[model samples]
Target: MLATYPIAATEQNWISATLLGALRISLETLQEGNAPPEFDEALSEEYREDFLRGPKFKKAYDLFIAKCRPLTVDQRAQVLTALNEQNNFPGVFTSTTPCCSIKDAFPDVHSAANELFKHAFEKLSEWKTPGCEQTIRAKYHQLVDAHLSHGSCPFCGYEPLEAADPDLVDPDLDHYLAVSIYPFAGVNLRNLTVMGDKCNRSYKGAQDILLDEHSARVDCFDPYGAEQVKLSLEGTRILSGPGEGPAWVIHFDPDIKSRNWRRVFKLETRLRANVLERHYKKWIEHFVSYAQRHGFDITSTDGAIDAVARFKETCEFDSYPAIGRLKTCFFELVEAALNDPMTVDRMRNFLVESA
Candidate 1:
């Protein structure tokens, strides 16, 4: 619980990588590494007869299968080990056009990959089916196991979030790079993470988390990295961005670099929910009451910031009000507001101060 917490990613992070590779092998076998639904039969009659129906497509597909197939246990380990590596797939597609190859009539990689996963996901529906079921079931069972063991959603650590692959068994794996924008990563293993429904569906639906120069390794919120997100508060609202903000009302950020993350995930709205607002207000109230009880002047901004800093120092990010990192950042707000007498009085008034 205390050592390496859910900063970078969960313990089951490797499950997606392995499954993705396994699925790709099976998926390609099903598709011949060609188009997903129906191959471009219209490309040419030669393609239609030979590649589509004749031995030509079968020949190419079989070659790819042989190339990727593992014969021995060591070969299997080597294949999986290679697959586990992050492709940085988005970066790999440096071409201006959307397609992987220009020769094909409809050479677009995005739609290709997207449809590939769409079919692959269906294949995952049951164990009886070859490609999809085994991997999807494994993902589901992992989530069920994690939830049962941890009690709290390991990803966000806030709500007693449920984990089930709703699309198959649950919708827990959020493509770190939303598959809609960067569909090339549709099957990329490291790109997917085990997330709660609230974090994945309710908040981050097609929003791109990888915009700007924000590297997923360094910036994105997963179970890896100790300091991926830095939270701060302006008044009662919590934010994560470039610097101490002039502040957004909840749906936005003043800084552009930080804005994409907040925008995609709707972090501002989630962080400033009424429940969290109450907790933030209560913290300010605690500080104010403590000052008043000792006849300490909060007008002394340094002292007030120091007090909040002390509280923040001992507080862990995963604890309640669930937005603890941002709550702790409210210490900065305390200091800023204390400098203005009106803001100070308003804060004091905001306090209920125990009967």
Candidate 2:
């Protein structure tokens, strides 16, 4: 299984901000133009009322979707031209359009369109699914046995398969969520990730150790709410929160941490020495070599990126040095792309600098 990265909120920071501003401005403009100041009323009733489903509203929404949805690439260009002329969405035939103007023509279609846009935005917001330990364990072994007949870890980069087919992979245990959880506007494809046995089995039978709404009051770091997620060179420790302000610390797995530490440094000590020292060394060399390509001076970054990569390789959760920042960055960049699509280049540049 080949892993695809998440569409992060960090990627969309600027674009979301801009769209929010534009949305407010548009609403304000509409209100100012109203003879009796209907902006507040409209805003208040937007959720409760199905204005777009009204006869006139539905007509406009239907017209808009029919013209815009079935439009060929060339037709889409023309729709854009007309929308640009009115400073509103393309093909909004109604004068008092709700939320998105495109929905003003076909009110019934409005809800579906709104749902589509909402799902797309939420997907880009760094949403994650709970990792399943049992599923991961079974799948991890199957994947390893299939690709590594010699019972060796593929961390050495000499494995037969570099990726996996998501369709065949079992979701209950071996399935990853990010790459397929959200759908893009154009096509639908799922990215299943192939990981080593040790990494996938880090948590083993304890996969539900993450913070949730019920656990939020007791746990300081919320994986979703925090601004930063700090992980160690090994997959054992995690510091979560914003900036340098970490609020909580937790031990994911001491055994995994010890194994990962030894694996990372290729230490001569006795951690897994008899079981797979040679294999471990090969994997270590592969990653150490990979890190050098990114200008992440292994000696200078204080093994920062090394730690991050190792965490990713080991435990799927509580692994990732400065994970919160990376997640924030990724989410923001993705969000910006969804909102504007024009800022993708700038967001990419930002990622290069931040990394």
Best by TM-score: 1
Error of 2 at 53 (Å): 28
Q: Which portions of model 2 show Cα errors greater than 4 Å?
A: 1-11, 34-116, 119-222, 226-355
lDDT of each: 0.44, 0.30
Q: What does the lDDT come to for candidate 1?
A: 0.44
Quote each prediction's TM-score. 0.47, 0.18
List runs of model 1 lying over 4 Å from the truth. Answer: 1-115, 119-160, 163-171, 180-184, 207-227, 234-255, 274-278, 282-322, 335-355
Worst 10 residues of 1 by lDDT: 1-10
Looking at candidate 2, what is the lDDT of residue 172?
A: 24
Per-residue lDDT value at 351 in model 2: 29
User: How well is each residue in 207-238 modelled by candidate 1, as lDDT tens digits?
Assistant: 65644335332233333333234444444433
lDDT per residue for candidate 2 within 1-355, as digits (tens), equals 0111222312322212322233344333333442222222322242213233234433432333443454444544433332232222211212233212233343433354344333323332232223423232233434444543333222221223333344443222211212122111101111122334443444222221122224221111111121222322222111222343112222222333223322332322211242223232343344345555655554433343343344334322211222322333323323333234464444333323344
